[model samples]
Target: MTKISTTQTQDMHSALTQAIRSEPSLIGGHEKSLKGDAGDGSTVVVSAEEIQLMGIAQPWDWKPDPVGQITMEKFQFCDLEPAKDSGKYFSPGGQSFSSGYRDFLALLSPDFQPQSILSAVKTTNQPPTSGASKSGWLNVLNNAGQLEQKPSYSTSESPEGWIAQVSTQNTEHKLTLEFESGDVSVATSSKEVSVPPDQVYKIQITATAWQRIQIFPGTWYNQAIITIAKARESQYLAGGMAQVAFGPGGLINSRVSEFVVAMMPSAVVTMDEQFASSQQIQASDIQQVKVGGFHFSKGSPESAAKLQPQSVFQSASAGSGKTTISASETHATHPYILAVIIQKFG
Candidate 1:
């Protein structure tokens, strides 16, 4: 290594202090234009009198040297497989082996290759070399259980001390530790404290760990992943009927007659469509008549007449006078009262 003498180091430090003092915060003042081009009949000169009057610091006199080209080295991954064995494989420095198949030896033939990575299957009919046959149908917990499952970790060694937290949305017995000895610590919503130097552990969480999800359906997930998605969708849909309404023409509260008709459980959707188009009466006349279990407008008979078969209206008239009433006096005073009753109850 090269070293600088004491005298040179002292001189360098002194020069740096002087350079810092001479520099001004605002490096340059406003500039003015000179009208004529260089080859034109105009002359340029610096005012020596003004230069002497306001002695500002001179600009750096050094010219910029050209920078040499820099080429970055490309990265490569080795294709070699690792060793595989029974006990946990360790490096000379005690680091765990990165690959399982290459690191450990066969308790059973490490040579066996399963057909599908995701599917449920046992490649061999034989049992484990050491453990009893947990491989057969009755003994198998799940297809996933066949593979080596990673061990889970947990700890309560936090400074504040905590066992775990419970979630409200699911029925499963789940625990979320506030701190895992030397991994993570639970704090306020926006903050988290890391575990201290004593320990560092890893914990595996299950699908049930999510436990609760209150995300808005269909669109919220898309919006979160691609940040400007919602804003871009809004901008694209602006000024169209698909857009949410804003000012004057926006009819957020306005209800459609078809929706009101659809709310009736027995009302056929086809009939509701016909009714909305046919009943063109004033709002006050909507309840004036009754037919086929629907409260009809005054104009509804005319509307229904246009759609109803001629044979059906004639059949209705024959039944009106023959009711067990036996006489007009025993009947309702209003001729349309029976129709109103049918409409109201229906």
Candidate 2:
């Protein structure tokens, strides 16, 4: 038996790239869904239970974790052996052993033991945040109501708010602020600014241009929502098939199906508006297209199959072939499916 090594597997994948490029039919349109990249970051995991509650398939379904499988070589290519019952080949003893078709079938049969992954893993969902920053200029007002200098916030803090004198030069500016994943918000010196001391707030600053900014103590983790976005084809090697144990000592499996896709608008740093606004995609038009997810296989069709479209509202007739669930009287799955379906269909 020929055992497959990691390097050997990579070599096999390399060979597959060449082979697939040389012969497109082998992969059968598997490369179409890949779009952006997740890069070297932490895994974005979603429990199966979460999928059920949302009436959406697992994100992994769209972006499968194929990391380990794709990296393996033997899986890239299979072998066949000749059969003994068919009278196709003459033995050294001058006896015909088997028929050609029988020999072929015998060689093709395999006892498959799918390589098992022992840990929960996922692919990067959305691309790495670009232009997202933790520190930005927070401009407030001086006690005299004059604009002061913009002060940078501490990167270590979260759910933090600041009030400072706006730079005299930037007085007219409406406080252009930036934060990681668009998570943080700033309230200017305007009357609209309101904060409850009991509510969880990270760092806060009281504004006074000449008097120096006052840093107030507040709760940092009051209401925190951590989103983990995963790409379509990342690999997850766990100890069991559907049932697996997570770190340290507990049985965690796909049975825990209700997880939440927290739509924290504040956390949305930015959409790839550049990609969305290039005139390549029309705002009014919907498309069924495929974009790359994490740990994906090399082929497009296969990659696309892993993802389920969301954020689009097509007629139920349009949803026929797609794996969609509908409520008796209404299609309650909103906005997410529309975009998903458009991307997939287009």
Say which candidate scores most in lDDT: 2
- Candidate 2: global Cα-lDDT? 0.19
Residues 197-292, model 2: lDDT tens digits: 222112211111111111121111100111111122222222231122222111221111011111100101122323223323322232232211
Evaluated at residue 146, the lDDT of candidate 2 is: 49
Residue range 50-74, candidate 1, lDDT tens digits = 0000011111111221122111100
RMSD of each: 39.6, 29.4
lDDT of all predictions? 0.18, 0.19
TM-score of each: 0.11, 0.15
Question: What's the count of clashing pairs in each model shown?
Answer: 10, 88
In candidate 1, how many Å is residue 200 off?
A: 10
